[model samples]
Target: MTDPTPPRPGSRAGRKASGAARRRTASTGARIREEGAPRVRLPRRLAPRKSPTQDRARETVEAILEAAVDLFSSRGYARTSTNHIARRAGVSVGSLYQYFPNKDAVLTALLARHLAAVESAIHACIPPLRDPAVPLRDGIRRLLELLREVHEADPRLSRAIEQQVGQMPVVPEGLAGYKRDHVATLAEILSTRPDVRPGNHALMAVLLAAVTETVSVVLVHAAPARFGRDEMLDEAVEALCRFVERPPGRLS
Candidate 1:
């Protein structure tokens, strides 16, 4: 019999078989991840998986957050005791305390959750906008639209924030990085014009977020008939755009 020899690398059957093998490997890996199975070492494909216990932990955390929104937003953080949150969540006070130290801690977590959701919406809305005159305008409009939607969807919480502006929860840990990066992005958008370096962009970004937030809070309180959401958004975006475009030494 002739010696069995390896097929050439370019053989069609070999290529087909290789492709089929890769598909099978990917399917198996996806299944393993879904089932939370222990990772199997393989040169072709490997991935980390979230185990069963991880799912339960996630549920518990989310339940606490929901309870928090109800308690803090409805009753205010100071009045919403740990026991109240526990009962609302259908979990033991001990369990509730395990995730949070005090009412402040719970509020902190809630703020983080709220900030994360807002950031996600902003991420979807702002990006790759190039024009200095119109980019900020469009970006601010999108941001305010998202804010109005979020605020209207939960008007009670929004009112709570409005009524207790001074007591608004302190910005959470690790949030500074997000705020910083976000500011940098805004600055970059504003800096496309002459005489502005990328290095100075961050300051502009910070100013943008701060000014927009202040304007948004004001807009939420004004009469809807006159300064309706869209009108308010337009005014705010226009003001911001003009501020960014102001000629040097034009402002007193």
Candidate 2:
């Protein structure tokens, strides 16, 4: 058989293919720049798209939110004002009102953004629950690892969400319930283990959250010099495993 002719680069057909590939690459890069470049990487609102006029209106709405987080997290919510958020964000009061109805709405959105961030971080790292040992220390470690990863990734946001914002009144509190829900899940997993009983899940949940948050506070934030976060997280997971696996008679 005759040898195949060598393919010619820069030929008409080759150039057309190369040009198409270059366009695809450029368009993909642009999409990535837009999608990947998030402000604070927070989730956007679910509201419908605005008309061109409304789009100009949205700049002020964004400013209001940005200012609300800064002021509310810095000054007390009671001290911050809609007018203040407007001025600080560099938009007019009327412009701010175009999106947000009141200060509470602003606070709620910010808190939601915070929660959405932490939760998204957690969800992204969580693998599928397929293994039988998932209810055991293996599963517990996954959660602890996830918790630590989130805390270590954004220690400030963690502190702000768990403690600072929880204390604020401008936003209606969902945090207590949020913690309780996590506790409940932990309790459920603990209950499935041989040593832990179904009755103790509630208590275990409290313990789990307490240990995780305490370690996060002390090791990661309060006294970084004295303790290590990775060490604390590993130890906390071990302690929780003991709580679920240790027999009732082995109680200290």
Candidate 3:
């Protein structure tokens, strides 16, 4: 009778088949990586096709951006398309193209708008932080609260923009300036505060800012059900306060 068994692992045929399978797997992985890599878009390609000068044009652009935010937030960046955005916006694909060159360009515009709002809110908080009456911890708390509010404005959209930041050019080109400004401003304010330890104010500002942002983003998205917002905020405030108030300790 003919053998009904498949090739055994120890057999030469099995080894050959395994080797071919490994090669195919490797080729597939390479192709997937290539396809998944972020595309380097040229500046012109990312820029809007035209500025919205008229009231009607501006309204159309706003509608498109709003639609993009809704779609990108609900469906995610990968699933959302330019056609979808235009349709949701109640505009023609050609109209959206007139304002945004492509989907990435729409994303860039949304990122810009969101960043501008955040930057404004941050700047507004800086004046209060500089107030002589405001305690260091209190000022920090106020700033953190403001950041949380801004982030909460459109949490889903904010998360979506953050997720797609790597694929867009605006982050490095536009966001860098805003970040530098915030860092410099915070450093300056920290230097003036009498309670702050007399070390590297710039580094301190960076740490404080980073911690606040990280904590806020985490709490907004991945926070546990048991942990309330006020509880998390209090913990963050205490942690940041201790870092700035306490002197440097030796590493064990």
Q: Number of clashing residue pairs in every model?
A: 0, 0, 0
Candidates in descending TM-score order: 3, 1, 2
TM-score to native of every candidate shown: 0.60, 0.59, 0.73
TM accuracy, model 1:
0.60
Which candidate tops lDDT? 3
> Is 2 or 3 the stronger prediction by TM-score?
3
Name every residue pair that clashes in candidate 3.
Answer: none
Residue pairs clashing in model 2 are: none
Winner by TM-score: 3
TM-score of 3: 0.73
The whole-model lDDT of each prediction reads 0.56, 0.54, 0.72
lDDT of 3 by residue, 75-175 (tens): 89988778777666656689898877788888877776677667766877888788757777887787678778878889999999978986654554545
lDDT of each residue in 1-252, candidate 2, tens digit only: 432222222221222232353121222222212221113322233221221133334444555666666666566577767777765765557766666655565665555666655555444423322244455566656755665565665565456555656555533335335556555665565565555545556776787668766754554666666656567667767776676565567547
Residue pairs in candidate 1 whose N, alpha carbon or C atoms collide under 3 angstroms = none
The parts of candidate 2 lying over 4 Å away from their true place are 1-59, 120-130, 149-158, 164-180, 195-199, 217-219, 247-252
lDDT of 1 by residue, 118-138 (tens): 576667766634544444456
In candidate 3, clashing pairs total 0
